[model samples]
Target: MSALLLDTAPLRSSPEYRRLWIGLTLAGVGSQLGVTAVALQVYELTRSSFAVGLVGLVSFVPLVVLGLYGGALVDAHDRRRVIVLSSAALLVASVLIAGQAWLDVGSVVLLLGLVALQSAAFAVNSPARTAIIPMLVPVEQLPAANALGTLSMNLGVTVGPLVGGLLVGTVGFGPAYTIDVVTLLVALVTVLSLPPLPPLGGARKAGLASVLEGLRLLRGWRNVRMTFLLDICAMVLSQPRALFPAVGAVLIGGGATTAGVLASSVAVGSVLASLVSGPLGRVHRHGVAIAVSVAAWGAAIVAFGLVLLLASPSAAHTGSVTSTAVPWASWHLWAACTALAAAGAADAVSSVFRQTVLQSAAPDWARGRLQGVFIVVVAGGPRLGDLVAGADADALGEALAAVVGGVACVLAVVVLMAWQRGFLRYDARDPVP
Candidate 1:
């Protein structure tokens, strides 16, 4: 547990934190539903892997464009209001999606476009949302607060897609989106009731100047820069999620249902890991924990690929008839689950430190901006991986793509950790701010 959480565990006893957690949890579920809707809908309509991949492309561009500005806006405005406004925007997009499905008017371009708008709205929401955490909980309890938040989020995300896949597969798209809208409204109403969180370090009059100013601070802070860079490489190199469906159908031979099960398993692993992280909270060292955690993540991914290899070599040999398709069976599917679960759990441990480092290292005045950039890499890296790995899935094969990403991630983490002497030496006792 980070100092923020352990010292402040008594504070989480407050009603406000409970409400905030509940609200965010419901909204997290809704958001995951919306995400799953886009991917599954796109794939269903176009039946093209590339079109499915474009979902990330659509979401990423707007999110990247609005991200820094959103951070500045969060710094410049009320955190609660920003979250409410952004949640409302997301609701509108959800309503729009529901309407599209209701009318039987489905255009992949239009769907992607609306999903992009929702992404933009969400882009505005996160910085304020993250910045609000310190206000809701004491600084000392922030890590525990964060740990709880992670548990809720992982639960929502894991269950959302599994339910969503079943819903989209059975109940139809209209209901899936409608559920998201209801959840968002709940989140909005819950946030509206919280006590006011004053702007950190007084509001900077909002402008590009503030954004650049935030950037300047992060640049000068060596620990923040180094940890974030390692995060980027770690995420970019080994994100094999885009290939899950393909792997389910081709490599594992269970199809979409299997994909959902496999996909949900990753989040299950993350949730289980976090739930059991009593020891992860006690670590005193930042650099060693982060480096080792991420390297474990990379190695787990490689282990995942190797499992695929061991499952069925004949999986790659396709026949025109479905009967001739080689069956990799479900045990390999279980192995993939084990590997991904380990990866998610390790990554979660890594996340606690990374967030701690960023908050401790950056001046509170500029934490939102640094977090905004952090959000960008956090969100953006997956999309980048989708493009890279999705294309590779077409050209090479899903198993091979997983292997490729795994190798790159291991090398990147080792090199980055070796070079970032500053991050390794950072002490939490003396906060950079």
Candidate 2:
């Protein structure tokens, strides 16, 4: 096997990481189902794109606010216990949703509220989980550990939405929610099997102080700060999944099926890339690797938007960019799918390096807290991207918004590469502490 694949082996070899990976993947599947059901139910009831956005928005504050404190808590407390509590909360929330569904008393308001609760539970659980990885595997294997996490996320992201949409459409929301409950229960067993994680030695108490400490540490490192900023920019600007339903209906004309297909495409790319990512094990210049991958993502997205403009039929909706020459199959949907997939593949590469950088750089005591913040940023990014894409799609157009976002992603990465000399110049072999 290539070194990249072998590097990840250390992570795969760890029994505890393996168990957590499986559990989290299953839980993620359930969560996505609940999300799809809520969005479907909200749109069906209120018949408003705004309501769908609201479902995402409602989950935001809980995820952000709790994310920081929760990470700090992860640093100060037992990680295994935190995972248990988070899982338990998610389980209860899933049960509540299932009960309401079974009783046929579904309320959009109630569903949104429950989603917020589940997100908050996840807020606590996510950081502890991220923090625990270093403990489970040796230091050099951190990149592989991160790759494993990304792989699971890609699988869950792609499969979960499709399954969630299918289950809701076929058997009603009850079955959709119940599946999550069952999966979550199965995940709980994984958590139960984990050994206790004592707090890292010399970790500070959890509070605003800890939050500030995390912020300070993250900012002190020029690369980390820029990385976090770049993530925010790319996510808040160019994410296209939020606009998928509208695009499927108005642009591609396939409804939920198309949306599912489109949604899964990005994950498809990521999974495929990661599967062959054994090459990643050989690279040492992780910073340059991250910067270049992000730039590639920008180019891919821009190309996707170009697909829309180049197709004649899409040109009609997008105001005659292609002029009735190109075939229908060569239109907006195909382009979007292609670009999103490319972006996903590139992101997986960047993620492996970024995770490695942080794992190696972070102080032992503060690792959990910092990781918690990272998880929060990572999780909440898509929602922000959704809102941004949705708003822009209303004012400008979906095609235009995607194009702009892609350009922005490219520009941002280029700027970061130029500015963060230390990050770009840092040697992986010798390391920089």
Candidate 3:
């Protein structure tokens, strides 16, 4: 039974992997704390949701450009050193955010600028970190390694916001930022302790040429390319999270707390999925697993939309009922949360397969650049989805928007599966990149 649970072989196999994982878990929680602080602080300063939205706009360009170039840098230099430098940059950004809060500076623009810089540094940091995982564990254990990484990330997302809220409410923003700084310093210590990981097959200087070469390789890898496409279809078409507020206001009728429950339900589902992901490590047909998981995600979204559309008219107008005050006996809210949880679980499965495939299929020489592109897609897809879902909700009610989006996502996956027949049959035992 333990063997059927999440595999701990990778942690047992390498002391370095254990240290890296521990440091990253701590740092991830801190990063989430900082993210919540920034959002709350921005709202406090500007008193506008649009200003908070600008955080994404400011961070997007730097993330893309730096993510691509940074991947090339990872391929060219010692990955350990690159990660160390990026960690330092992250620490500096945390300090600056804390300083601003402590000094009572009210410049939203400056705060956004620092956020953008932090994001750019993150783009560089993510690829190097991902590209290092395969180096730390054996080939057969790649799936377990990816699952562990996913577990840490999901844990951070699940717990960090609550911690941040508590800290900000009682202590303040300065303390939240200080906590982030401390976490980063601990993460840096782990990076410094790592053995040097210079690129294999001689160092190719990071330049436009190196970036292009990575792109060229990616373009030819059919299975890897399909993973990105499938993820985009699922995220861009079916992710209705940006509409949670509206759903809570008009459809679910629990107001802000209801919206928060809907948002957090996804994370709850994801964490649960990760906890029992032991069987996933042994599955070999990764491409099919990804496709099936995404289809499940779309189906869950469709069900969720239908639930909203079919609710009692009186239930929709019960706005006086706050989410916090609502009892667990509230069947309607539980149903909705259950749907979101199912969607989250399906998405987590897809993510694990995608990460495993990317790490295993790509060669050591080109892994960093491909991982960089993956980072950009992961970050940008939901932002784009928000725009699409928002516009659709405005034009056609939120319920209908969600339904249409889910249907579209399912159809897109069908088309991709048909077009990339090879991807569906791809075997982990004999990966081809």
Candidate 4:
């Protein structure tokens, strides 16, 4: 039973890690609340889903542009100081968001600008925080530590939007944003307590040269590079999120509510997987584990697509009726959710190993920059997946699109494994990056 449960060894072994984990979890929830509030406010102000989507665009741009720079900054300075400044920037952004809402400024541009600032801060803050984990915990415990991190993130994803919606709908955006401000402050205080983490050898100047130096490490490090490639395969080729709205309305008959349920199912699976990830820390063939997990994700997605096909004969056609209430008794809905949950679990497992490999294998000086790139791949891959999934659904029907994507993802993994045979033999005990 202990082997099957989540390993709390990392938390028990390191007080600093425990405090940092708690702070990150709270701040993650708060960040989600702010995201939900901002999206809702945009919709209320403009009544346009497209306008709401612009929020993602603004956020993504800064994250991509600054993510590497942030990592460079981490490598160049005391990581603790970098985190403190960036977290302060996040708090200031949250305060402005709340102020604007309270003042009834009602400007879409202003709201977007604030979101960009928050995203830029996050771009810097995340890499520094992630890079510090190795410094705080034992090498053998990296997987467990990463699993805990993933658990917290998924928890925020699972809980934040629901609470944010309630707060915004019942009260107003101000209260939601205000709560975020409080959470950010907590995060800031926790970071302040962390000891100075100066660069080990000597700090490189944080500039384009430093950033490019970090990027160059990827060229020589095949194992670390494979981690990014596998993740991209899983997220880009097999991700089925964009198809949720159509799947709920037409094949599943649940409408927007159904879409919400389907979307949340993934996070639920992630949380459950994290809870039972104790055995993952003992595994040594991390590369093989990553491949198998990604393959499982593809298989689960394929199962989800088949369930959709089985549920409705007219699934390929457009203009179907959408329902308000979920058909709780329907086997198709249950099956589809189960498949999505499985995919989520596989994804969570893959993520633990991937992060462990990156953190364990990369040199400390380059960890921050690599983590920045990791953040970019993590954030950007899903958006690209949305575009790919949407295009495929439009041309080939959602069910077939999903089927094609799953197949593609599995095939891509196979090809990658064949090309980099060494990746399959990568042992965690002797990390090679």
Q: Which candidate has the top score in TM-score? A: 1
Write the residue-wise lDDT of candidate 4 on 158-246 in tens digits.
Answer: 66655665566467778888998998898889878888888778798999998898888999999999999999998878778667656
How far in Å is the alpha carbon of 352 misplaced in model 4?
1.0
Better of 1 and 3 by TM-score: 1
Encode model 3's per-residue lDDT on 1-433: one tens digit a residue. 7866788889999988898898788888788777766755664565444454456556666888888899998989999999999988988888898899888888998998998888888889988988989889998888888888888876766666556645664567788788888888888898788998888787778999888888888779999988989989988788776565555545656544455566667767888998899999788899899999999888888888888787644553444212333334567678878888898889889999999899988988889899888887776566556556766767776778889989999999999999889998889999887
lDDT of 2 by residue, 163-274 (tens): 7666654567788889889999999998999999877675568899988888888756776665666666566666766666555545654445455566777888888888
Which parts of model 4 are misplaced by more than 4 Å?
Answer: 34-57, 95-114, 165-179, 242-260, 308-333, 390-401
Worst 10 residues of 4 by lDDT: 313-322
Q: How many clashes (backbone atoms < 3 Å, residues ≥3 apart in a chain or on different chains) does model 4 have?
A: 0
Error of 1 at 145 (Å): 1.4
lDDT of 1: 0.73
**Where does model 2 exceed 4 Å of error?**
1-8, 100-106, 308-332
